[model samples]
Target: MAEFSNSNTVIVAAGENLPLTETAVKAPACIVHREGSGLVTLRGLTSGQCRARFKVSFGGNIAIPTGGTVGPISVALAVGGEPLTSATAIVTPAAVENYFNVFVAAFIEVPRGCCVTVAVKNTSTQAVSIANSNLIVERVA
Candidate 1:
């Protein structure tokens, strides 16, 4: 039987459009997202099945209109700047001012030395606030 391993969890509090200008610092266990760009890059991963999970809590003060998009939050898993799987959640009129959590998971192929990143973006007219956000990656194989 093969032993399974999990990577360290990376977290970001503020949920904003990550800048595409800078790269995050490299780490052996886990990589943290950049200040402007909400992306975490991991290196030296094995090529196999890996599970990625993300959770985000967000809310706004303004009431969301019926059928109107208040806040749209998107999380994605990418390798070499290409997205493999992505999930998006939007705040509806019923979820205004309340903290909502968005969870996404997927099994993907992680290539060795390939930069793996978790990114978040918010596309809403109103100002959105994120209370907490986190990402976890585990090697199932």
Candidate 2:
């Protein structure tokens, strides 16, 4: 007999500060695992701090319940490759000087072979661009 195992995270892209309303904007599928540990790190470079908007939404048209740690969303901002935070809000790609850091922790339960969509938006009026962003998923031994 053979044991079974699986896990993965798809890289999503947002072009030219645009809203992802097209079929091409669909994010890759994430494998579902009964148990595992993982983390996702998003890094985008810009001229200054911009209020970067990001969301971890359910794959496809399926809607997940809100107000739960699972599938929760987060945002982080950095300036000159350094971190900065305000009393109430952290800096973001939208807020150049305030670069914010947001983490959702291990709060989501992804079904095997299923993918979660992570969308990042630049809400600032200034011209800002996304440099690099990546996601990772791992299975614990």
Candidate 3:
């Protein structure tokens, strides 16, 4: 099995997409992705290997806005614009500007030739900041 991975140390604003700009020095040909992109396309999958185990891992420091009373964050893996079932990760912050270490990881099964993405949703009523974040994707046979 070939594995392709990328990451970016950047902030994902509220209700905005994330682009993993840092491509790996060594990349696999089967997985195609553009630099500074948020989508990963799978290629060259046969019936025997139609299903791939997709692993998404990410972490960031976050801070809630002043007078915020809502919950933390929800992270998940989505394929073809639909979130996977039972693949969501949640993190809750207890204090203000506490440098919370929020890490979310999901392992999902995807068919061949599908586009995968990492999604972060804010559950709080106030705006939250996610900084110094990175996302990594891996394929498992």
Candidate 4:
């Protein structure tokens, strides 16, 4: 079995989409973290079934306009730029004591040297703050 994991506590701005990189998250030895990129290189593996998991903890502060709406925070898993799965949650106003969390899990066929990435996106008009996030990948064959 092969496995890799990373975590981030940095704040992600509103309306921003970022790929979680290995350098930024400091993944363990089984996974090679790319510098300045969201992709994590899976090493010592061949074509097989792999499972990926993404989790994001985020919140924001904004006064919704009379007829405006807040947003749905989203987290996604992708392999070589192709989206495998995604999870989304509604974010409530900061004053309302609402914090949003999203988790996504996907099973995909990963070829040797394939790149796996986890991404977070804030679709709200107001800036949303991310408290922390985590990603885990495991080879199950």
Top candidate, metric TM-score = 3
Indicate which candidate wins on lDDT.
3
lDDT of 4 at 4: 27
lDDT of 4 by residue, 16-85 (tens): 5544533333444445654434555554354353433322232222223323345444434545544444
Candidate 2 C-alpha lDDT tens digits along 1-141: 111111122122212111222232322222221222122222222224332222332111111112212221222222222222321111233222222233321222333333342223322323332222222222221
lDDT of 1 at 136: 47
In terms of lDDT, the poorest run of 10 residues in model 2 is 1-10
How well does candidate 2 match the true structure in TM-score terms?
0.23
Clashing pairs in 1: 18-37, 18-38, 19-36, 19-37
Clashes of 3: 0
Arrange candidates by lDDT, descending.
3, 4, 1, 2
Model 1 lowest lDDT segment of ten: 1-10
Give the residue spans of candidate 1 off by over 4 A: 1-37, 47-86, 123-126
Q: List the residue pairs that clash in candidate 3.
A: none
TM-score winner between 1 and 3, please give it.
3
Model 3 Cα shift for residue 135 (angstroms)? 1.6
Q: Provide the RMSD of all predictions against the true structure, rounded to 1 decimal.
A: 9.0, 18.2, 4.0, 6.4
The digit string of per-residue lDDT tens for model 1 on 39-99 reads: 5554434544343322222211222333434555333334444443444455453464445
